[model samples]
Target: MICLVGAGPRGLAVLERLCANHAGENELVIHVVDPFPPGSGRIWREQQSPQLLMNTVSSQVSQFTDESIDCSGPIRPGPSLHGWLQSHDSDADQGRRGPDDYPSRRLYGRYLRWVFDRVVADAPDTVRVVVHRATAVALEDADNGQCVTLDDGNRLAGMDAVVLSLGHSDTELTGKERQLAGFAERHGLRYFPPANPADLDFDKIDAGEAVGVRGLGLAFFDVLALVMEGRGGRFVPSDKGLRYRPSGREPTLYAGAHHGIPDYARGRNQKGVAGKHRPRFLTADAAHRIRENPEATFRRDVWPLLDAEVRTVYYQALVAQRGGSSAASNFLKDYLSEPDDPGTLRRHGLTASDEWSWERLGQPWRPHEFSDHATFNQWLLGHLREDIGHAEVGNVDDPVKAALDVIRDLHKEIRLAIDRSGVIGSSYRDEVIHWFTPLSTLFSAGPPPLRVEQMAALIECGLLQVVGPEPQVRTDPTGACFLIGSATIPGKQIRTTSLIEARIPKPDLKHSANPLLCFLVETGQCRPYHIPDPDGAYESGGLDVTPRPYRLIDAAGVPHSRRFAYGPPTESVFWFLNETIRPGIGSMILEDADAISRAALTC
Candidate 1:
């Protein structure tokens, strides 16, 4: 018997692998545990609003096995998500979508549920799947193997193995956030901690009330849509751009992030480009060397390869887009290579605004340049419009846009390099995982272009204000409102009755509030994952796992082969974990499931 916890997409992948590998009449029983339905998971639940859209295009996602995937047994192939939707023959507006169109997340959720049902129905007669719609709160060693205790006080036992596939963690508020909540309650003001934007209650905020919203990424877009469109506003395209018609029910919003850098729009389809960028310099082999080396630092060993790949693609695209004009492209390259150098700018005949734009492009918060709110707002408007232009032309037609696309493509190779336990050096792992990955994600994997245009329109219409970058909030002395300030606009301040942190909290095992995680940590069954420091100390973060078979490592330093872990909790071992799984597209989730299933079969 095998127990797969949290039956989301990762859990479904494991089941698929297990079912595919079953050969003879060797009876196998797999139990799936989750309060919600399997496959679609909580993040992509069907109940979410239609206004919430997936960042990925229809053709980019697949629930089926494909030729590119290599499993331990015979292959099981089926339709991709787009193919499945087409097969349904539904006439709903979201249905019958094209390859390039971004489907509503609710529609994708339905596709996931369909895949789940099909897999279960087609499983071999020798395999039995039992799903338990209950939350697992604890796990421990049983006489036969292991046991899982649910929140309802029932316990499941006699499991041969357990695979932890806990998806995104809806983290508890931090101490600061808790304090903010207390302040809100005492002062009779509204305060919401970080949560899925779709899950937030927007009705509590009345029309014309100023609300301070933190972060300016994809979540903010969701909030903007709910507060505006939910209030009977409509977004219509005009000759100027996207024009917003308000319903006189919108709240006044003060929004910005640490860098005040709104995500770049999703690129238009590049004609003749069939698939993702094929890395010339940063290949799997190049990344393999870093993986094999015990002491290779990310900055010293890995970043150069990535840098070379970016520069290579940028120069190539520039020359190709400029009709093979190497001389002009070369000058432009020199200008980018030394953005702050006046001599280089002069050589390229670039204007002051051009130089400033390049500087701000590299570092989103060049604080010295903007004198006040008016100037900063002007620069932001121009910057977003120019970026939209590049996105409109398609990544291939614009070299800079193409280079950003290539940065996203690098994720696959990066995942392959780090997925192996103990392959990455500790410091390099910390630097890459903590710093570089999030920053790159902000720029490359942002929301669709239409959403950004809507946000800009919201800013222009006075419904939203761009509170300068890195805005921090605190309760005012009288405890009546929150005082918000930003470093860019020193001394100046804004006050609001409500505050909302508009970003997803990072997953950290040490601070996790999940009942299961707490129980596991409190006991000796599992512990926070740790890596060795240069000074021989240890730095712990995620859940520790054994290298090859991906078993959980306990506090006493024993590998629990019968209890494996996958998904976000294993980030320290796998570097990146939040991506949507796609067949033949470097699907690390599938690779992980295959390995775990192979181990379970042996047990």
Candidate 2:
């Protein structure tokens, strides 16, 4: 028997691969374990509010391994999310269910369930799949095989091998968070630590209450949706564009982060599933060379190639927009030959201001110092309007969006350069992880354009207030509330009774709230991955595992032969574990799943 824990997207993919590779020579019993349903799992569970939508368009997401995925296992073609909706005749029923449309998370969960059912139904006669709708609490070695204990006090013994595909997991709160929670408890305030937005109880926050939100990423938007539209508010077209109609049940949200701006809106989808930016400068060979280097750092070695790649696209799009397609081709040829020469840019009618700057793009609010909240809010509104304009132009045609889209497209190559101590560990931690990753994410991986439009409308409607840049939140003992201010705009403190941390908890094995992970570490079944640095070993907060099959490594540094782990659990070991598998791209998700499935089958 082979056990698959956490039946989320990754688990579902692994199951698909296992069936595809099954020889059918012997009986195969697969046990799938999770507290949630087999397909949607915790985060994407079908019960989530339909107001919470997927960031990705329907055409891009797929559960099956197609011909695009380069794997040793057989290709199992299946419908993309859009195709599935069409197949079920639900596309027309659900308004705006086109290929480029952002489907609701609940709808996506339904798709995942359909995919799971199809996979199970089409399994070979020799394969038998049994699902345990209980969390796998513990695993132990059992006489040449393994045994998995579930939360329901049942045990499945004699498992050949087990795969841990635990997706997003709850993490222990940090010292500051703990202090905030303690203060809130003492003073009768509400403090929510980092969590999945869907899990948080929004009703606990009183209507018209001043609530301070800590992070302005995707989760903040979810919070915005829940508290505003989820409470019966509506967005109707106005002379000013989308105008928000208040529900009066909405709480006033004071949201801000280090940047004190929402994540950049995703460029409108012009390119379909098959269209992707082909890297010219940051190619596979270039990434390989950087990976092979002993002293390579991301900023020093990798960023140059990445910078060139972005500029190449940016300028080519600029030229194409101005001159023509033929001129753009000639410009690319010349730019490839003399990438550093400013004369080429000059000849193409490009100025220094037209040059791409990731730093500038990331921190657009850095240059200005707002005197007050109103001044800052006005500036922010203008910024959001400009961003929406660019987004409306679409990712393919817009110069800026097309350039930024390179960051998303070339992520695999970037991962290749940084994963598994490819770059020096110290630089990897400080430069790549702390610096570049967040900036790149802010630029590329963001909410849909419509969300940004709504955000602007909310700001105009005076429902959501951006505190300021470089936001700082702390407990106010005197006021008995949370005091949120900013370093950039000082002397402007906003006090609130409710404080919600609008971000997911960072994965830390030592601080994981999951009982199985805690048990694994305490029992020495697994250890946290550490990157080697000259100063000291940097703890990565991810499970240490071997390459390929990703066998879990123990405290004594021995790889467990019968165990494997992947997805968010092994985050720092492999970069960007949360990204879903795209249909046409050679997705690392499918490749990793295929590897683990093949290895597990061998047992």
Candidate 3:
């Protein structure tokens, strides 16, 4: 019997690959384990509020393999999530949804569940798929194989293979968070620690109380939705933009980030062109170069090509949008002159900043000063309106938007470089993962544009406020309230009775609160992933995995063939593995899954 832990989307992808590889095999029995639903998992579970919507468009989501995809295994061409929903005669609501529409996460969760069920039904009679609705708490090496201990004190042994597809873990309060918690308890202040935004209880804070929020990402959007619309406020169409009609039930929210940068509003989806972009410079040749040379750094070798790709796309879009214009001609001349140089692009006024200062994605303007909250709200409202306008025009017509789209599409190539070099423990990898990745995400993978417009309306109505460019939070000495201040707006600090951190913590096995992960580390079944720094110093934090087939590397510096891992924990090995699995060229998730499944078949 084979075992798959944490039956989320990643797990399902791995399982599907296995089924394809081992179809009609009578002796195979796969035991799937997770406390949450198998396919949707915890984050995308159906229980989430409908207000929470998917960032990706409907047509982009699929659980089945398609003909266009060149999978190493069997190609099972099936309907995408949107196509499947449209095919069903019973679901008229889902049928009416189009390719470009961003559906509610709840509805998408249902589709995932349906996909999981379909996979099970289509499996060969010989392949027994047993799903256990219990958490796998621990795994120990046994005389025969690995023994998996469930949360209920039951153990299953003699597993031929184990796929660790564990999804995002709950964040444990760290240094400042722990201190804040203690301060909250002592002072009777409210402290909502890092959690799934949907799971938050809004009733904890009163209507008029000021609440400080940390981070400005997708989670922050959910928090904003809950704090505003969930409290009986409504966003209506208006001449200026969306106008908010408040029920006066929301607490005054103050939000800011380190850079005081909000996520770039998502651009309009080009329905038919998902995964269609092909990189010219960031090709297989570039990947091989990284693999051949141990001295290669991502920033030095790979970023130029990635940056050039974006510049090329941006210039192309500009030329197309302003055909025959002098501006377009100038852009084309500069772009063609040095096709692969960012300095050339910058000199020729091809940068996003050069094209349009305010429309630039992910680059925050500094020292945002407002005489009062009202003035700050007005500026924020205007900023959102401008961003929404860019989105409405679509990326092809919007040069800044097109550049952001190009950067987003480079995820595959970037992942390829990471895979080729295995830059996990290096300082360059650290810089890329910590700085570059987040910047790319903000520019490319932000919320749907409509959400930003709605948020503007909320700000206009005083429910939300941009308190600072980068706000720092500290508990009061007397333990009465939380003090939030920004360096940008010095001497201007706000005291709030409550504070909530609206961001997910990175996966670190050493500090993981999950019982299974903790047990795995304690028992020497797995060790924290580490790689050498530029000076040849090794660092650890990421979950360790063998180079190929992704077997879990044990404490004794050995790879266990019967075990494998993918997704978030394996980020150091597979840098961009923290996304939904899709059937596309250079899709590491699919590629890794195929490799793991092939290994499983042999074992």
Most lDDT-accurate candidate: 2
Q: Write the per-residue lDDT of candidate 3 for residues 100-167, one digit (tens) a residue.
A: 77777777778778878988898877788998999889987788987899998778899878889897
lDDT of each: 0.77, 0.89, 0.75
Root-mean-square deviation per candidate: 3.6, 1.4, 3.0
lDDT digits (tens) for residues 427-507 of candidate 2: 988898799878887889889888999999999989888988788888885758999878787566999999999999988
Model 2, residue 470: C-alpha shift (Å): 0.9
Instruction: Point out where model 1 deviates above 4 Å.
Output: 90-96, 271-274, 324-359, 364-368, 416-426, 536-538
Backbone clash total, candidate 1: 0
Which candidate number would show the highest TM-score if scored against the true structure? 2
For model 1 the local lDDT of residue 151 reads 87
Each candidate structure's TM-score, on Cα atoms with residue i matched to residue i, is 0.91, 0.98, 0.92
**In model 2, how many backbone clashes occur?**
0
What's model 2's TM-score? 0.98
Clashes of each: 0, 0, 1
Order candidates by TM-score, high to low: 2, 3, 1
For model 1, where is the 10-residue window of minimal lDDT?
350-359
- Minimum summed lDDT over a 10-residue window in model 2 is located at 87-96
Q: Which ten residues in a row have the lowest lDDT in candidate 3?
A: 355-364
